[model samples]
Target: MITEKCVRDSFAEQAGYCKILGSSFMSDLLTGLGKQLDKSTETGRRVLQWSGDPAHKADALALRLAGALHALARSGQDQALAKFYHNPELSSDAEFIPAVLSAIAANDDELYQWLEFAPQTNEVARASIIYSGLSVIAKRFGLPLSLYEMGCSGGLNLQCAQFGYQFKGVEFGDNASILQLSPDWSGELPPDANVEILSRQGCDLNPLSVMDADDAAKLVAYLWPDQPLRIARVEAAIAIAKNDPPKLEKADAAAWVEDRFQADGAKGNVRVLYDTIAWNYFPDPVKDRIDQHMHEVGSAANADNPIAWLTFEFDEEDKGPFLKLRTWPGGGQAEILASADPHVNKIHWLQEN
Candidate 1:
């Protein structure tokens, strides 16, 4: 039996020395691990410890095999990869880490092969925060929003604006916004405010069409394992899409925003906003183009017909994550209101100096 203490120590060991795996790869590994909890025994615990050792040349390979084990456990399938995992000679092999990293980087059939072992769950917590944040922004802007999300995988976050939110101490359920915003405020909740979502649309370079169940599952599998709420949120979003799908377009973010900004309906009683956690993936030129387009649109905008750019992303200074608010007509500096969690959950409002 693998005691909880053993598991914790194992995870700590893995977490401390696995920086060489790169953040994105580590995220994927953690997510895979989350799904494999049931099948993770004492042997698996020892394997995780072995995988975390910085001095071990085969750590990366062990991690890869562990991820494979998790994927298998999630899929409700037999552990066919157990032989590869249990090989003693493979543990000390110098080439193991590099090989595993190469496989993940390639995103080849091996990645999918490992993914087949995991079960999907709801991971809506981050989306809930986004909905909450949007609600606050809409109130501040004095307009209903027609949200346009970039890099929306399966359009799950889009539905947060359409669904309901039920937190521990607070209860507010109407039309959900991009993030669900209702915490049990013991004192007083923000004034009985509401933002009409004129429309909800999203674009993804590699959009996961929810019409296909397998694609939907893959999207869920891609989510972080620590975020179980996201899994539920995704499942709910999938259900909503099946009933009445949101309008999703397949296009590049810069091109999509530029074209949409130039379109007629882009100027309406709605605020057009793009929120993404995808800055690292985009090139500098693409980022520049997006900024230019938003600036152009903002210059032409008015209080009567306002346009806003609201973003929750990471920057160099703050390092973690922050929310930026920019508006039209009064085109000034973007205000960093809160220092937020990368996962979009805990937000510490920054005090102005």
Candidate 2:
């Protein structure tokens, strides 16, 4: 049972993250709301009495509430709330607090319903790290790759190479691409190798497609209002994805991996399973099964058809996610390439590559 203390703690915890992620307004808003949320209202009752662990790594309860309110503000139904959100620095807590409370009371049903779904921020900026990892893999194996991603919200990162990147003075990808990113980069550059992806596929329990207007809106909405650059980057990436939409399927990741993907068949091409900031959402059972299947499949792998598991995800030891790579011959042992910001603004490469 999630205690009231735990629920409140989650809001405070998420507020801290908001500050770290460069959203002082959101941090302030969450802190204020946690102290003042009226438990008598439907939305407040639902949040205060939530059943599950409400932490960002768990149910992300705070983010859900934040997203819901942001959506309402964007919809233009509450002009006062919209003004506060758009110009947060100019609004005082006295005005902001009451507007939020009034908004919650009026749209309790909608906000409550919004909390049911997890936030899917298919961040495109993280591609800088991912493409860099692929460079290392390509340099090592010198083979074309077959890319598969699990928990791919809209499969935007599946089409990462389609977007452009400029890592610390190093240029990569198509220069003409609309959604270009130059994350604050560190460490030596990986030796250039052709990362020709023969095919790219992704699976998720609830895959959002770039073609869906509602899904695209939600994807953009999940970003903090203060960080308009992040929001604009995702929007541009979504536009890029629409031209050559990602090949995505709605399916269980473990089931898909065990039943469909095989490490042995694709001769002369390296099979790569990669995910960016999506591993935490997987249930423990699913994660275990996926690991087991990879190990089993890897056991039969060879030099001609190598299998690689690449990830930009949180490990037990780090504050942020690490770019990790594990190969077939070296099953169960992953090399930590670099550590990066969750939203992909900075990266410190641990390895020279």
Candidate 3:
């Protein structure tokens, strides 16, 4: 059912997403990259028949090339292209991009290996929106929070407490922390609440270990070349994670949620389940199991102990992704909170916090 146009269309949409997210450099590069894929080169053919789900078609190919280019640039193996990524002046010269891409695609072995892996964006900038939501939940519940994240690659966000946060001019977390998040915060600030992370754990189908050099490189490589700030944040987060890595397990999300909800939380812990942009990948049955489990466990929740689900994901009919929160003991009805750009560039708060 997959046609070449299907592949081309995915890239075109992804390119637009990059542009809207403030990465004009990535937008241009991806536009050029799509044309290169249409040329039926070895790389193009490989991408044309991508074996993964349709939702990931474009991202899978883009990440493969980006990761390979990043590896080369980091090793100083391709000084010309390395400078292109580091210096905006050189990369903006559109005339030089085709040659650079061609040279990158010439390495068949590397590209092939990259194609074998899925795109693990593991973007940490999104932590800004997540932090905002979590702050709201903790304040609403007034209980020590126990966090569990699904689709947590490298589990960097699981270490969010270690990173500093700045929302609408209010700041918190380790001020000395290198990984600070001060996004273009807008709207009236949510009620300031004390956050206590009693425990944190995460699960990914194929989890990357921050402790492993090769795994860490893949995580860093997936970052867009033009966004130096994002690249820097990933590097800083990796360094922070090395000291104390998250308790990440390689497991299926539905099964993990079932097990987590079935177990009893300590006396006063508020069990929190959350993820950013990871829900769409779950199959229908998996989604059903998780939903049913949440409802069943939620019915048993009491005021002294609680359960909350926080999600930042795409809503097909909405202008952008919606931030929805549902809490038990008060009845787990979904409350639409905010709509944010795909990369969390800007957020529009919809409810009074």
How large is the C-alpha RMSD of every model relative to the true structure? 10.3, 2.8, 3.2
Error of 2 at 220 (Å): 2.0
lDDT of 3 by residue, 1-353 (tens): 77666666666677787788777766766666666654445666777676554343435566566566666677666666677667644555865476556656666556657767776878887777777777788899898788999999889888787888776667866668999987666667756777788998999999999999889988888787778888899899999999988899999999999988863555698899998888888888998899899988988888788999999998656445888899988889999877777777776777786
Tens digits of per-residue lDDT, candidate 2, 186-234, equal 8877567787888889999999888987787788778888888888888
* Comparing 1 and 2 on lDDT, the stronger one: 2
Best by TM-score: 2
Runs in model 3 deviating more than 4 A are 1-21, 31-60, 92-107, 316-319
Write one digit per residue (lDDT tens) for candidate 1, span 47-144. Answer: 43432332223233334444554344345443333222334234335443344334333334444344223222224455544655566557666777
Candidate 3: deviation at residue 183, Å? 2.4
Cα-based lDDT at residue 301, candidate 1? 77
* Ordering by lDDT: 2, 3, 1
Choose 1 or 2, whichever is better by TM-score.
2
The local distance difference test score of model 3 is 0.77
TM-score of 2: 0.87
